[model samples]
Target chain A: MTAVAQPEPARRRTASPLARAWAFVRRNAISVFGVLALVYLLLPIVVVIVFSFNDPAGRYNYTWEGFTTEHWTNPFGPPGLGDAMEASLKVAGLATLAATILGTLAALALVRYHFRGRGATNLLIFIPLAAPEIVLGASLLTLFLNWGVSTGFWTIVIAHIMFCISFVVVTVRARLVGFDRHLEEAAMDLGANEYVTFWKVTLPLIAPGILAGALLAFSLSIDDFVITNFNSGTTVTFPLYVWGSARLGVPPEVNVIGTMIFGVAIAIMLANVLFQWRRTPKGAQ
Target chain B: MTFFHRHRWLTPYVLLAPALAWLVLFFVVPLFWLSITSLQEGTVQVGYTFTWAWENYSNAIREYHTQFFRALLYAGIATVVALLISYPLAYWIAFRGGRWKNVLLLCIIAPFFVTYLIRTLAWQNILSDNGFVLDVLKTIGLVADDGRLLATSTAVVAGITYNFLPFMALPLYVSLEQIDRSLIEAAEDLYASSAKAFLRVTLPLSMPGVIAGTLLTFIPAAGDFINAQLLGTPNQYMIGNVIQSKFLVITDYGQAAALSVLVMAVILVLIAVYTRLLGTERLAG
Candidate 1:
């Protein structure tokens, strides 16, 4: 500790004010840049939220006219916006559930057990992650066409699940890698059956990870445009609706939906953080 | 229960079966099916037959080479921009955020929960000819009287960087957060300046995150069409736009499949080389 401490005073003593100022600038540059970067990230979302209440005279909401609550009062004023939102929600829900289950199981198998095809399985899972969305979407379209199956709701769900599963596996597996396996062994040693031990001991510990993965899958599915575009045929997800409307003129209700989704997501995330903080012992932190 | 306990080797396989089957049927088979479809010859209306048409690959490369190159160039620029914008924010969140670290990280990610199309469309408003950004730029003499921000390659790249910034930031934050402060202290103790210490000690340690972040940003950006479609004119369209138009607008499945396969192959080879150059061991973290 002394050796570590010695350099600071000595450097301070030798350094001039200009040098000290330079050092301070160097030290704080990242933090400053970080704040600016955060602002850049939030800029578009802010536009969306602010524009949600803007009552444009024309169909295009690109320019703000004046503030009004008309859009919020009739949030589904757009022709197909409500249906598209419903389709997106349904797809996101089903895809998240399926991806979470499959991913958690794969993660368990990969982390808890060693087998012959383990490396192959890992590679297989990663292929989807590394592949571009365009390729995945196009290829899936081709597959459906060749198989004599048309693209629609089921096809969108399948496509969402396919890409989403890989993400779920990656996120859940990261969590599992840090987990302590001895708890499971201890549970079993206490005369609990394997099923009971897994259910009681392992499942609860990894539940947060699973939930996080599911949230990620849900968001990815809901926001997805490329894959859904290819496999959606006549089906219109929220993103598809937005794309179609952009050519004509985007409605203010689209901004309303965007703001609502953002609000709900932020609320849930804050709640999670608050819950975690409350649960953790002060000393542990 | 007895039979399950006795045949424990089958447990992993049984657990993995559902996901493995799902991936094999949807993911792996589609990749093979894509490759086969790429080799077929015909239009969507006429129907395709497999004659091992290798020319499709060459034709895709030959015909749309400009779009392919543009896609790579745009994605490359966007990745670099994202890295530049994300690294400092990630570093600050990792090291300087203190008790608010989780919240800061959440802020970086919060904007993503909104629909992607809406976010991109928001860019349309922000960069409009009479928008505040352009007005400011025009007043500052950074932009000419008639110069516009929209319908340009720069707008497309900016949108790509904004949309994918979180992917770069999160991985970087993960790796940077794991770095021990003691190691940095030790470097200072050894008489290294802060900048030198960061370059020698901190930078090298974060290479894995850098590679991961870059790949995460670059891969998706390369295939992204929404930014180009929404922000830029046809001149700025990427390979994704071309593939999307082929599959949906023109209904040329054969060419679309070929282009998709080519893109996938190129990305795979690039990733392989990247992993080899960076050393795959670092990625295990």
Candidate 2:
């Protein structure tokens, strides 16, 4: 302990007052600016949420005309948001499942083994991550046309999966790097088969990473507009619907949908924070 | 070599199979198909025959020179702006936020969870002629009585920057947080000024973040179609907008594919140079 304590006084003496002030400012700035930035980030979302309850003529300036549940209750009215919401959820859910499975499998393979062309394979996987989404979307469209496959839900799902898989692989790979391989090896040594060892030991260890990746995938799929717009013929996700509607002046109900989605995301993120906090070492927290 | 003893040969390939298969099927094959489509001369209707035309590339460059170049310019500017704005926030969050770090981090990420389209559309409400932002600006006499923020290239660029700021911040934060505190303290103890220490030590250590964040923000912003479509008219349309119009409205697959291939090539080159310069190990972290 004495060996580490020797340089402390010298370090303090040499530090300048300006440097000390800068350090103080640097440290506290996140909390200060974080509050401002947080407010900036959430302002639009909060405004949208609040305006969702306004009367139908809440266009330029939103005045609270008492309260109206008309948007949520009568979702199938003139501006039927229900259909779009349902479609978005269905597409996002399916895409999430497909991407998660594919991504997890790919991650496991890359992390656990070294193969010929591993470098090339790594590049290929990350290519999707780095590729401009517009290029990817256009390429997929062209490929589909050349193969004579009409654009539909399947095409959208496939496109979503293509992008989402990379995220899954990237997230899971990070977890796998710090992972101890000994547990699986020990399981195999104790008469467990390869599959059993993986199932019993490896799967549980990587489950949190998988969940994080899956949540990310789900959000990406839900929030996608460009690729989904390209592939869906007459189909519309919530974003697409919102975009189309904004051309004719945005209805207040769209704000309601936005608010609901924002609320759900906040809930999920808060839960994630709590879950992580519980899992963290007490000292670290 | 004993075949039975060399189970390593099988293990690596087995582990890598799924990822390799996915990359080949979705990414590589699709890219090759797009390339082939680009080389063809005709539209999709007359059954695009192989023509091996190099004219498409030159034509794309000739016809959309301004839009293409403008897209790149906007992307570059937005990326730089986001980086400039995000660095201090990311730096504070990473090195100095203390116990509120994770909570603040969540706040940074929370905006991303909302549907991107909705967020941008909300900006419309804020920036509309009689909207809050415009009203505030007018009150301070920043514009004429009719000055508007929407339907302009600046709005599209600003929107892109606003949405993508987190991508820049997170990667930068990750890189900055990974920096050793001892290095900074060591410089201080050696009687180096804070500004000197930051320039010599902090900036160099954070190069990986700058590279990754720039790539992450710039690539997407370059090809962003929705921002132009929603916020700006034909004059502000980007390369991505052109690609979409070609494939969907114009039904010009050859031109679309050619455009896509050009972007893919450009991005790939960027990635190669970036990875080479920054080294993937650092950026990947």
Candidate 3:
């Protein structure tokens, strides 16, 4: 298939130098732009990594100074940074777990069965995604306040779960919609009970989707700022910490943490990719 | 257990129970509460009352109309910029990336894992008055002697463009990748130039992605306050900033709820009009 799709070298060989050059440019323009776009996206990330090693002369790590491993060596040296990170991790961990469980079940029901209010359920799931984060945050804040519940870590977690559930549902549902139900039926026909079929077959089929959804929920919860800001009272997540300190001067430790996160995420993604690669035949790729 | 097996219809509802309950409790209820809160009258000191103060909406618009328009304008520009940058990138990955496609896609999303606040902060360093970017611009005389990049509307818009670029790219890639290669090849077989083939076949086919990407980019960017808050001054403040302050700092629940409702309402209307303009039939998965 690739061989058939390949351009004819004979036609290209007959072209004049200028025409060939123009054709090359025209053919590769999109790829060139893609590379440039990737560079644009990574520019700030590179800056973060570089600055993480810098021994800044002042509180703000904006200016470059002599290179040092101080920030990396003691990432939690900055006051409030560790606390904020702990808060963020706590919220993300809890939110991801809840969202994943609820969302996986919802996705299963949505995809595997026909039920009343299914259309409404689908539409309801989309509303949070379409609605602005500010509105979600504000509405939740109002609900908490009206109920006389103080805004704090719990409020942030609730807000995070509210928004994160929609994404989890969407992600898991996409995977479920493409799933082959024959396998589950086959397992049942082979004398497996319904629970056994679900545990041994259906769950395995959807595990990747659930895992992806959980990762997304975690990232969303951890990276969230807008929604977290409105609901959080005195509690500070990492983003809130950065927001507060930005006016003063952000410490280099923030950059160190950022770099570490980037590194970890990339490592996980690479592992997933390599796993997928190993599962597929080389020629198929 | 026998009763449960006999009533097969109950199973899906059971599966969906927890998720639907959570969504209803947290999302739907708060939305209703937000609407009521928007109509309430009072400050945090006196506590809010359900006086049906419809004028809160008018007052919010009247007072913060500048911020409202500025938010839309900045978001619109950012969406357009992101689209312009992302289209070619998505096209390349879809049609030309071959086995490296997933890797390239991962690279695009990798920066997002670093945390939104930190990425924006890195931009602060990059676009600082005396930073490398501005220095180069000044040296090239594109900027005046005293001209700066940070704390300007440009920086805020750029920050938004940077943050939401992936949201634009991913959908576009999906749509582009799904295009039938045979259509383009058939066009070429009919003696059409490659550009003509692309314009007539590929461009028309990718409209769904374009619409989806634009909405995904624009909606969030419009509601985003962080970029404007972190990178721009008060003069560049968007509606999100105003809503944030009204909710958090000022504790003026009425106005904040009103503004939140207004933003959500406006976005919903815009999305409706946009989908209609693009044709709702194309939006279905």
Candidate 4:
């Protein structure tokens, strides 16, 4: 009280260390929270990976018993696992190919041209994404029932493609929008035909976008359950197999496969990120 | 030399034809078919007929109002939780992150690439009665020994939040990343506190992402039944479970179709109100 702010000065000089520490905490609190949120996001994944090594005493792989690598070594030793994997791969491959081709073309048109029904096309592309997937599954099933089309492997593929096309279009369109049109114009001016220009210039430029879209479609189709469950009459995809088994009991093999999928997916994603970083200029990063 | 130059107006149509045909046959037509089926009397063995059964809607609303309310409430809560968690995370990745942004973002999303079913099942294990989560909670006197998380609404909502968190994070990241850094600097220059600058400047700019992310999370979460099926008891059953069982188990096609239509309508109305309340012109621009 002797000075105007002797207490404040003394506190800052000596006893304000606790307050300084709190100020530091307050400043970086959001960053710590962010990383903690990420850790929370990864917790279940960690659990899935951890249980892959668990040797369950019972049929249900709920409690931890002992550690074993048997499931990892023989992932498909469980009955129906091979069939489920094959069905999933076959459907995912076919749907991704078809959806990518169709969606790339649609994305190009939507981005490059001033056309009739452009707004309508945008709305149409958006509606599938906006609608609940249950509605899509129910609606498609109803159509199939009315038309008497048998539901099975092909039906699952059809349903996957139907839902995936919208996602593909959006992904490709995002890439298409950012690209410079001058490059394509230069190609055309350099005595390149339309087909050659597309194959040589435009296609290469849009290839990454197409690849990303294809990857997205593949994952969506492979991991789909609710829609697949409705459209698949007896076709047991990996998710369907998992669902059926979960009702009774789940094998450790499921965790093994899940861990493998997660690992492979991460590898692919990191590679893609590397590829993008290389393609973009050094200045951007 | 030019595809668009030669074909002029016809080019866009040609590009769009395949996707449009597929969407029309599988998506648009199926939805129309669903509406007709919703009005028809239906049975699995007897075959459905066009009998104008409006009672299907009335009966669904009367019979399943609680399930509807439960689904909406669970999804709503999950969306808010996801937003709260994602905002800080996305903000950090966008601004505070240096060269590690892409790597950090990839790590955050890598877990989601695992099969959806297996991950949800992982949640079942994580929240099991005698699991570490419960042990810690009980140790801290936060949970009674007899009060379990599994087979409860809490488990179901947690599953929803985990499953849809990435959907919220990605969009929020995109928006937060696109903000101009200089604007925040300008606010600081005007003697605004860090928190005030963030609240006044950063938050307003990120509203579009908030809208997009919330819609993406809420719409899918509301329609998802796997979480309820795997993690919660019958008491926590959602409308998705009701609709799924109706279509698959009971084969009450008309009522399921009606429920689908009603759910779609309600979601659409909700989206309209949401975008209106937030003012969509800003989002669109």
* C-alpha local distance difference test of each model: 0.88, 0.80, 0.89, 0.89
Q: Encode model 3's per-residue lDDT on B104-211: one tens digit a residue.
A: 989889878889999999999999976999989999999999999999999999999999989999989998988888777677667666678888889989989999
Clashing pairs in 4: none
Once fitted onto the true fold, the runs of candidate 3 whose alpha carbons sit more than 4 angstroms away are: A1-21, B281-285
Assess the local accuracy of residue B281 in candidate 4 as a C-alpha lDDT between 0 and 100. Answer: 73
Cα displacement (Å) at residue B18, model 4: 0.4
Ranking by TM-score: 3, 1, 4, 2
* Worst 10-residue lDDT window, candidate 1 chain A: A1-10
Query: What is the lDDT, from 0 to 100, of the residue A26 in candidate 2?
Result: 66
Say which candidate scores most in TM-score: 3
Write down the worst ten-residue block by lDDT for model 1 chain B: B276-285
The TM-score that candidate 2 achieves is 0.91
Considering TM-score, which of the candidate structures 1 and 3 is the better prediction for this target? 3
> Which pairs of residues clash in candidate 1, taking residues 3 or more apart in a chain or in different chains?
none
Which sequence of candidate numbers ranks them by lDDT, best first? 4, 3, 1, 2
| lDDT by residue (tens digit), candidate 2, B1-285 | 255246656765665676567667767788888898888887556788768978888898889878888888888888998898788888777765766678888878877867888888777666666567778878899867788888887788888888888889899989888888788878877887777888989988898889889999999998888788877889889889999899888888887888889888877787789788777665454
Assess the local accuracy of residue B104 in candidate 3 as a C-alpha lDDT between 0 and 100: 92
Candidate with the larger TM-score of 2 and 3? 3
Residue B215, candidate 4: Cα error in Å is 0.3
Question: Model 1: how far is A196 from its true place, Å?
Answer: 1.7
* Cα lDDT tens digits for candidate 3, A58-149: 77787878999988889998788899999999999999999999988988889989989999999989888988888888888889988999
Q: Which pairs clash in model 3?
A: none
Go through the candidates in order and give each one's DockQ. Answer: 0.65, 0.54, 0.71, 0.55
